[model samples]
Target: MTQQVPDKLVIAISSRALFDLDESHHIYETDGLAAYCAHQRAHESVPLAPGVAFPLVQKLLALNTPDPQRPRVEVILVSRNSADTGLRIFNSIRHSGLDIVRAAFTGGASSQRYLAAFGAHLFLSADAGDVRAAIDAGYAAATILPSSGQGEGAGGQLRIAFDGDAVLFSDVSERIYKQRGLAAFAANELAEAGTPLPGGPFKEFLAALHRIQADFPQDAAPLRTALITARSAPSHERAIRTLRAWNINIDEALFLGGMPKGPFLKAFGADIFFDDQQGHCDSARVHVATGHVPYGVANEAPASLPFSVVSQ
Candidate 1:
């Protein structure tokens, strides 16, 4: 009989997101792939430093310690490097003691194509193109942003923060807001408060997480989730009612209205934060490990909109 893939929360991540490869990446960009391959080979024995998503991966792996035989989470490394060039990354993984045995080294080919093959619930990568392709392919994916500070969840709790519209829920409401402005959006939300919003890209991923959380005691659960959005008051009611209808429990909900999300996300000690808007992601990445979910109205090409520095 063949061994079965465990029914768990599967996450597919890139080598750059797992470890700090900025120096090596710079070599690849400036000198070319040949120099990059040679550099990696030369530094093969050196352990790579942790990147923005390191803490999140560490805490996620810790969830399995409760039941080694039956782990709740699985992380797969997906990279564009060839198997020969990937030995350094593998060695670093060993040095860091990360239990990431599975990998797909595409040898410069597109690695996002293998995400479904690994049963990945989420894909995180520093490569924006790969992330965009994965999202377009209907997988829950995000472009990992560079972070100045490390994540704050040092207690082993996996704290995940998500933007409400275009992330947890569908972009329908967001499209309305973008087309008709705030007042009309609020009115629409008010009228549809009782109706549940359509599920977005991350909906299935959140449901999977909820299932895992249900398996553990409330106090013992290793994960916590939050809905961090700009929606507030009247508009917020619809989001709340929508989650209730779905029977999903959000550990925390922060409706910041139009305020910047960076400060709030920092206070929350989030291991990772996801948002559809680049502006929100720009702010959040400074304080927490942030991922850009390039979807919905805001991300659409702005043909009629006037050019502005902020918009750029």
Candidate 2:
């Protein structure tokens, strides 16, 4: 049985987010379930390649000292593959030297119900539907996108970035922008500059990370966080004050205004960046690993749900 660490920052990642299962997934999509299972059985001994979130997981796992009585971080594998076909994933984990110990394989079912049981602060997956479900449940979650990042982060420091107005803060302002105009949005922000923006989907997750960061001195913290938002000066005061009001310490805050975020994320050497907008996510994936929050005004589709981030 896997030992539980209740005090640590916990994350749950799906099989496809942890490793590249594109080959088998393609088989499942094209040739159906039987072929997919057969292929998995045939290649059960073959190790899978690392997927987009691998580097981030590696850094998170590395937070535990070599001989600690208890780990500071815990990662649980929550997958859709059945235990029969999941042997390959377990083998791949052993082969890759990853320290992941606990997992929940639900055959072909979604793992939304198990996230709370794992005490997960965050969830990453290739399935947008699952991510949305997790977010709706009030747990922080993101849909992992194809990584174009340089694999390794700056000198082993685990850096994370987030977007504003919809992700870190409720899309209240974003809704104004979409409905009225930029002028009205700016006016409203300036008016409510003293009032803190309501917490968005990621508030609790960020607070948890801040608690971990408190253990180390400012210069030596293992995890570094940045806020890269499209909101520029005049409107920037609200974002700053909102974080201050929450007592959350963000290492860097970039108010790019309307600037493209790809270059900034590349410069930040982020392990993963989260944004609620699809356009920003597409650009960010070119420079670093990106996740789509799919919450708030920016993600609303009148006709149907949006799952294009990693859908076949």
> Which number leads on lDDT?
1
Which candidate ranks first by TM-score, i.e. highest? 1
Q: List, in order, the clash count of every candidate structure.
A: 0, 0
Q: Each model's C-alpha lDDT?
A: 0.89, 0.88
Candidate 2's error at 79, in angstroms? Answer: 0.6
Provide the lDDT at 69 for model 1: 81
TM-score result, candidate 2: 0.95
- lDDT, candidate 1, at 158: 86
Write candidate 1's Cα lDDT for 1-312 as tens digits. 223466788999999999999999999999999999999999999999998888889998988898888888889999999999999999999999999989999999889999888889999999999998998999899999998755576377889999999999999998777777788789999999999999988998998888889988998778899999999889999999988988899899999987999999988889999999999998998899999998777777787543431321
Ten-residue region with minimum lDDT total, candidate 1: 303-312
Error of 1 at 290 (Å): 0.3
